[model samples]
Target: MEKEQKKNKKPAFVAVKGIYEIMPAEFPWWDRFLEVAEGVSKFYNFERIETGIVENADLFLRSAGGEGTDVHKEMFFIKSNKDKWVLRPEATASVARAYIEYGFSRLQQPVKLFYFGPMFRHENPQAGRYREFRQFGVEIIGGENDPVFDAQAISLASRILKEIGFKDVVVEVNSIGCRVCQPAIKKKIQKYYRTNIKKVCRDCQTRIDVNPFRVFDCKREECQEVKKAAPVFLDLVCSNCQKHLKDVLEYLEELSISYELNNNLVRGLDYYDRTVFEIFVEAGSKGEKKEENASKLAVGGGGRYDYLIEMIGGRPTAGVGFSFGVERIIEIMKKKEIKIPAQKNKYKSVFFVHVGEVAKKRSLKLVEELRKNGVGVIEGLSKDSFAKQLKMADKGGAEVAVILGQREVFEESVIIKNLKTGIQETVPVEKMAEEVKRHIK
Candidate 1:
């Protein structure tokens, strides 16, 4: 009966499906990505901002294109006593909400903000995709609808990727037109898809009526031909949008940023208008053999959302921003085998080895004191064997070892040993930290 009860005990659990753990071995890659992202953001004069993960469900439902879109279908709802809330599917909408709720508009014309955090969406996971993924994003909001801000936003995204080992990024840009011209463009897209409606996917068939722009975003093979032949909005945008797009392109050229004029690059979100862009890189980068059908991965993208602020209850505001999927970017870095620079220590690092209970009791204090003097130290206090402690020190790459046995502890002296040369010397306990520093150096 006791054995049966033991057998019935539950097994150890694991992380939820599609959730990934950032193990210690993978931290260097993450560090490099975040370092470049944050550095570039600050260099570009953008302030950092973080918003709560849980926000009102209606916040996204209203601004993220309502029902039927991928975001709408993939949200994870949270039970609450008050209004419905959800884990944010993206950051831009939350940033916009913060801009309005915090009254950021009262201070400046356009508030520039950047963020790095996790976003949630309940979707089928694949390589480089997860139920919860991290994003490094930026937002430019509240200013006049100047096109230069659009170019600057794009430039910032491009610079960060390039600095973080992505040398072959191509910016695929397009103009989806504003309210003034979208209606006509929509009609043209709808009419084109209507004739080929039977050939397209069921989703595209529905989108053609609900939002014809989204049909351009379909990946269905059946809809490819239909979408390719659909009307191009670039040719039909109003005079204002045309000039805006032209100005943004010229700024990009002036900055020497490479870009392609994509005719079918309407973004997935509903808030974007006037300018939309996506950054893509070939899978064969870093001298890898190129395949004829090597599909490009979109590391990041965003667009101008002039009406997003007003749409979400704030006064009229123009905003343009972009976000990079941290996982996708890191995946590309690993594929390229990009090396992260090793962390440098000005002072040499040493290992602390102690034997006997008395020395072990004194080991912690010595380690802390050495640290206070700018000496890097690794210690094995729980390790009772002197030989094992030294082995651990060598494995940790420590340059020197500080030995403290019971006799040395009582005598007020310690042994300083060079790990590489195997040289040894006895020093006063007060000078042990300094002696180790000197030898390691």
Candidate 2:
């Protein structure tokens, strides 16, 4: 009875909620993004870097705004008997940790690095937001506190999005004051919120004492209403911050990058100071409806974090960067029906077809030989039907097909067939590579 019940028990297994699988069908979009990222990185002189996915939890806790912040609330902690570790919630913090640990600070000034990987955040998934999502970004660290680098980073991000077919890319930029004037701005916000706290949302009410600057990041209509009347960061910035922001805007204008100087654009972090900005695809572009929450559709954002390195135990090094959510970019591509141009590589333009048991057994060796000669030989050796194999070669858009059968295998030769035309020729096995290359060319 126990054995019968055990045999009848249904298998209980399903993917975790909020997490998603990136299947083969969805890889073309991913490949397009990565291809663009690689090309841009090379053009911009950014070196690629990758850090461990798991790190000490305190690495993020110390860098991110403690409590009430998105990172603090959504960070996924890995359970362990020893010290607690976590799957990194963001790449910037991990990059900072690596820079300090690897002594990148001692290298050339402003070491530019690019990274692409998954981040884990246990947040409610929506639209293109998932628990496990990919992010590719470039960080410029260890430079003089220069506004030009800020513009360059922004330009790089804008260039990437536009290259990938996003239209009307507008930058929402702001300066959240420096440490010298931040306290005063926070005090003004607190005093203003204290008087009309009732009009604000519950989150903003708590933000009043915890981190008054965060009140600007609130999305609630009631909070936004009260926030409009509250203290603006630009109104309270010091002279140096004012000059820095003005210089950044001038650079943007010089580059012809569209931007809006928003006083309410306080990014959701404590470590960001001076320059802060977010990149958005303006609604009404590509026939998108202009919704009220269109600002919430930010594809990417980052800013100058002069204090982030110091906060994470490195010397006070200046850093600026921006990241795009891969899922969000892919979603927009699908929605807009943007056609990513198929990669054109001569190596991948040829297909190999085989028939009979002997040819099937020998096809593997021939395929490897072609691959060794820098040819991307694709095959369907498992299919026993010769007609079906040829059909597949045509469907794959192969310019040429290398055919082999039991007789050809015995003769130590391969039939070189032009897939576009019906012309065919038998080539000696020793000269097969040369003939295939010539035909494909």
Candidate 3:
């Protein structure tokens, strides 16, 4: 029985598919990011929402457009009893579904909601792209198709990033235009690409037929050559779209926000429209001491989605939101040597070290009592040595350790060892929990 138990306890030698451990040391950084995200959301009057990861596959297939978009092509599909479910590639569709399902429209004019959690996809893990990753997203569902909400939505994301202690980040904006002009512009651009397809890369060639706008998003060197003559989507914007684009820019300027009109900033997904923007920082730029060489790293993006709610069977409603890749942000923060305080509070208490089996058994219950009284308690019940357990308590940042032994237990008392002071005192067993809490503070 002991041998089998030991074998079962063996450490795992291989990590599971697309899954990685979030070590305890790294948790403080994640907690800091979450805290900042919550603070910014609260300041903006955005409520929090948590939707399940498993969603119907068609919701994405339709929301992401049929065949060519990133979500449709790179998603992980799971087979259930009779239907196919998918890990949500992103959160906007799920947020839209939540808004429709819960009848949130009745509460307020534009229901602002924020969510931070792990979103999944099956993709080659690179620096920024991961199979399983965390996204901090916010959605504004409701209100007229106003560009003010569009500017506000993007600004909310920028504000959240700014509060997270990042500098040198630029807000890049573009108007993909509304439904009236979006397709017409894509068709016009495709006509130019149709003639230039032979000169572009193979993927760009296929993109010309299915998703004509994405052809301009090519990152290949050979494709860049063909892009010199590719028609810009903004060149064909209709009158209303042209006016909306101009107004959005005016609003941004009113906010004292600096932005560059990147006409080529088409988002990867099909759901985006009219207002599309990305936030990036140039590494090695002045005023960016915290993140050296973190230049042009795409931190977050968002746009308007007035047609998405109606596409999913809900009444026509304008929706817009942005999401931040938490892991990628953390990666950049680490490379820049940026610091987030881990242990904000001082050590509250210490471990109970046991010298014998009986002492170990009795100390477990006492440790629980300390914890119940709002005290942080550390323990090493498996350890047989008093020295090793005391060392562990010190490493746990415990200010004191409660020593339990045969004599102390029989006398209905325990010895308290102050780790920092090296002072010891025997206290009555009944007062053990209370005294430890008092002394640690």
Local accuracy of candidate 1 as per-residue lDDT tens digits, 1-441: 122346777547756889867878788899999989999999999999999999888899889778766778899888755778899999999999999999998977789999999999899988768999999999999879999999999999999988877767789999999999999999988888888878999889898888788888888888888777778888899999999999999999999999999898988889999999998866565776777538578899999999888888888888999998889888888888877877655767888999999999998999899999999888988889988898898789987888999999999998998888888999999998777778876
- Order of quality (lDDT): 1, 2, 3
TM of each candidate vs. truth: 0.94, 0.92, 0.87
- Model 3, residue pairs in steric clash: 281-296, 282-295, 283-294, 283-295
* Most accurate candidate by lDDT: 1
The C-alpha lDDT values of all candidates are: 0.88, 0.86, 0.80
Worst 10 residues of 3 by lDDT: 285-294
lDDT of 2 at 374: 79
lDDT of 2 by residue, 24-85 (tens): 87888889988988788879999999999999988888998776577878988888548778
What candidate 3 gets wrong by more than 4 Å, as runs, is 1-13, 68-70, 228-235, 254-256, 282-294, 345-347
Question: What lDDT score is found at residue 136 in candidate 1?
Answer: 95
In Å, residue 163's CA in model 1 sits off its true spot by: 1.2
Candidate 1 weakest ten by summed lDDT = 1-10
